[model samples]
Target: MLAALAAGCPGGDQRSISGKVTYDFVPATYSATTGTGTLAFAQASKRPVRNAVVQLRQGSGVIATTNTDEQGNYRLVYIPEDDSGELSVQVLAKTSSPQIQVEDNTDGNAIWAMGAKLSGTDAESESGTTLSLHAGHGWTGSAYDATRRVAAPFAVLDSMYTAAKAFMAVRPVSFPALKVNWSPDNVPQGGDKASGFISTSHFSPAENEIYILGKAGADTDEFDSHVIVHEWGHYFENNLSRSDSPGGPHGRGDVLDPRIAFGEGYGNAIAAILLPESLYVDTVWSGSGGSLTAFGIDAETEPLDTDDPTPGVFSEASVHRLLYDLYDSGTNESSYDKVSVGLGPFYDALAGLQKTTPSMTTIASFITALKEQPGVDSAAVNTLLSRYNIGPITSIWGEGDSRMFPMYFSVGSYPYNGTLTLDGGYEYNTWYQNQYYVFVGNGSRVTASVNSTYDVALTLYQQGDVLGGSDKTTSGTESVSLTTQNNAIYVLVVTGFKETDGGYGISISITSP
Candidate 1:
């Protein structure tokens, strides 16, 4: 339910004062059991007495009113309504002295301090509205200015709340809290020069705040709403993973693999799904004047080549293009003619996989699986292969390994784990013929144990070489040296044929030392 709005002032006139109504710092004592409350305002002896009229208005229309008691206290009924929209309370002071200005003092400890009370509702509704004040310590004036700035835009704040509520209904996963503030000091500025920031997007489970930049009567830009919503999406993704790692990079073999690309892609996807209208269709590859054929490979320059084995950049534009193609292809929806049409088949396939293999439900999971496989790098190529389940292993082992290309190889004696070394590391098996090789050390020295149980086998082959080797091994090292044939292309394999049940770790180092 929305908050209640005060009644309109009497008289149907052509002109009206439109603004938000805050009881200021006035304190009110109300009973939780009963929906009744009292507002108390202090009176100054030097100031002349006056009759104060307080009325609640929803938009330009008034709803209720009451006069202040002799003690400057007022009692009113609480009517719950859609006052979530912009509303204000107008105060009119009637004084006997013509020249004396009656100080309402409503902005002081009167309304702002006590806050508004809730009546005609349950305990939840009884809690008063709370506006947080965040001013850097030792700067009370700046703090007050910030508070006042946001205070002036209560109407806009209310509207934002309503909009948020609506947005949540469609995207329950995006459970964002509301935050209100006086200015943009808390938000980050563009290109490096900016001041304080206030965000309605909280990374934690707390409510978000909206800030009004102490500037009086200034309206927030429409883009601000979009930015806040996008931030909320980050929060949603964070919570969904239940781990902070999902929002950042992860380590892999002495390298920091960035997860931001995938994370941002998902965020953008969520944004598109939630607020399709908010995005400029023209900016998207699927939109007007854009086509999947132009994705990554510029149609004007590179031209589309379905047979191109190499992958290209998987930028946001490219990813969006793929998604758009899937959506348009009817793969997302069901239809015969549309089968394999656009990117729809791909998206639908991924969604289906997520249901059965929940681990693959997230983009991160898909990336992790791809990274673990051997030799699959380019983002665009990974996405393409992952879509068809023809990943690193499958790409090599399946379908005759059509994509297989030898990269490098090794064959020689080398120190094993900085300890025992081996010599005469040569194999006469058929597996050695025509196979790629990646050598680690020169074939000059031998320091490994002579016992057959401490021997190691090495082999090299292209993607289709998944089947020739025996799955038995123990202790040993294998290395092969190859010249730069076809740009450093060759494949090398090392195996320890030791008669032991325990597992051994092998280190592969490249370069001559």
Candidate 2:
């Protein structure tokens, strides 16, 4: 679930403190067309700190607090009924959660640390009701001041901006400002994971939103650059490029859909590229502290290479490994190590050719674009692709595969009929899918049907664009008919339910009168 926070109110207190919270950082140079720029790490400037925790205090006692909005503006309201004629309040900023709850809350064991006192104000109750104060770098010290524990948001912002800038550095296309929502209230209540609505952190594609969970003193995400970049990578894929990933619960070893494999694997690979870090870490918050796990692409420890002997065509590990090998400049023993094509070629391919490829968005489509990219060596590309068991990519349509058995059939004339058997089990059907290609004449009405021993689904496509599909009927039998122009190519895809496979017979007939 999304974080929903209301404004803070101190009842019976007739005065209010309102202000803005901001931080200073070096912004990268950007271009919307060429994506070439440099990082101004030597200098820095100030920008509003959004969703920061701001608090109001009365003589070391807590009164009220609220989070800064997207614009970094915040207001704390108080009633001065019982206080003296003048009320003095202290305004402070912390790097941790402003609202930490122990039970029945979304934020679990969250914290607000690395605090700096912003200002102190004295207001005449019921007389001078409003005062303005701004909390930022200069308000505490120099413009480039570094305060430990309180600069978590700085790291988060830096990683996000850096990644976006890197993208622009390659293919300078303008994208909308990303909206990030964070709060200490984004935790599960009473350690019940099921009742929790929001994840620790994730990128929502439909809403174009980023959510960060602030579990005070427990788990926090602002410090994990790899994790932040990984999530941002998802935003890049969905918004800037095209992703047909069927969203679901996936893990490292799961046999994923090809689309999901490509999307997840690309996200992982891009994180490492943006940061150029060998160790990728994810910190999980538990009680008072957190534990982290790290993985790598080229190294033996936590390597992207899979242990599964029969890791199929839809393995995320293979996709990420191939991508990492292609981008890594280090002279590792990997196949593509000699040819460090860098992130620029990959970005160009994704934003240009892969966006509208005729085939499904998979490793094949990406490799097809990569081969077409200028300055890329085809021999090195084949070496890396073949090493990952994805087969040597001979064409974008995947015509000549040395491994995993490539299958495609053509229909040349009307009244053409054929019989094919589909099987999937521990021994017979180890993989998840079976596909065939059909070609037909213009204005031809083509009808195809399937009869199988297990529940099956049928999808018809031209290139990668899905034209028609069927799964509504029962008993594993389905038929579809379509009419298109002369010599149009279509792919017939059939699969069992939940990766289950059994014998099936399919027949196709075409007529053009």
Candidate 3:
């Protein structure tokens, strides 16, 4: 039973009305493990509903209007001094505009206000009043229609709205609106089959779509606020920030490609910051009356912080924990984490520096961006950086990195010769072996070769686009020859026949007849 409040004004003095908006929520179809049979809505629960517009009115005319913030609170001020004190508070019928309901392709019932009530006060005295709004719920027979009608999609929208508002708060800009497709079979065809909630959501820039899981039991994701925000975070990176991430399967403690590590870690870290809660949980369960599993971002269970034994610069877990350590006031009690800079600095780094970094978007580039911010103490920044076994903050190229393997050490100016060890850890994200970059002049034909006792292969690439490769046998040398068109840079990769490891010599020279 939520209502709007109308305060009284005396002697032409100004008056105000303020209140919070909350909704009676029912978890239509939620699973902690696997979603089975017919999905049923959970019991009614209450939570704040944000971004609804509220108005203070007299008779048929409006005095002032304001919209709720992320917390679902709003205030209307400067009402004319009404001697009669007769007034009413109203919640606008439409909570969102046409442009905002991109996901609801059918009917766009983006949101609905259940019902509204009004309160009146005696004339002549100036005082303030408060009230709340109770939102309504309805459903259509179609599964897709029902999803858009329920709290899951609304919750996802709310979380994304909260994140978008956070970015605009720091620097105002027009945020791109997109659709979120939530259904049991929302994932791509031939994609991994989900048990309950697909556990992952992906953004397709080409289609401008985000498909979420609405599968009852097997895998649905509407109720997982962090997962929603995390997916939205990816959308932001793809839209606003530069994502050079080689997209693939990744998770905690994985030695990912640096690009993938930063991109995924940024998403995970920001989700925690947006919620700012003590725990980041992803619950899984079976069908109705089934057992439940709660995967909390608890240090003891998912110890991703500095204490992680396999702390690699390439670890997504390390990247996520590092970003969280930088943005949150919470501490793991092992280091100087009290220097939490919160979301302002983190957002600044993401939207400002990381978005346009010259190098591949990696943790090194991210740290470089953080250090360049005015008034940021490099020492304090390094203190947190060092905790993850990364030695120090030097160049954005990640030079002098004693912890991470020397994977990207350049081949220097070409006509170049260098010796590299193709050790077992040289594999990047389970695909590439060891890749190194070199420069070549336009119209130049170059011979790139690798010599080693172990069976090795050689590949040539220009800015990640493979030019050519040569893999002859499993116990000798390999080489490839290509002519450059423009003044282009190239990358030389060394890999074993079977991802083996050993000493290798690489050479590149301008071809001469």
lDDT of 3: 0.58
Model 1 lDDT-worst window of ten: 292-301
Model 2: lDDT of residue 197: 43
Compare candidates 2 and 3 on lDDT and give the better one: 3
- lDDT per residue, candidate 3, 30-55, as tens digits? 33234222223345566776775566
User: Relative to the true structure, how large is the alpha-carbon lDDT of every model?
Assistant: 0.29, 0.56, 0.58
Across 1-513, the per-residue lDDT of candidate 2 in tens digits comes to: 011223324425356667665554433333323423322334545556555556565544456666667566777777543443333333222222222111212333222222323333445434443443332322122122233223444456546766776776777667665655544445523343323445557777876766555454344555456667878887777666666555555666666656677777787778878876644555443433332222333222233344333343566767776677787775455444455787789888887667776555677678888888899998887776666667777665565454323544666766666666655542212234455546654666777677665566677777556678878765777777787767666666655553444545554443444
lDDT of 1 by residue, 1-513 (tens): 112222223422122222222322222233323423322223101111122344544545545555444334443333434544343444433211111111112121111111222222321234333221211111132122443322222222322333334444534424333333333233322221124333222233233223332221222221233333334445444333321112322111111111233334344443443343223111111324322111012111111233222221122232332333223322343221122222222223333332232121223333333333344343544444343322432222122122222212233433433222222222222111112333332433322221233555543332212222323444333444333223222234444433334433444443432
| Deviating ranges (above 4 Å) for candidate 2 | 1-157, 180-205, 208-224, 253-257, 285-308, 311-313, 331-336, 404-430, 434-441, 444-448, 460-466, 481-489, 498-513
Please state the error at residue 266 of candidate 3 in Å: 1.6
Candidate 1 lands at a TM-score of 0.31
Using lDDT, give the best candidate's number. 3
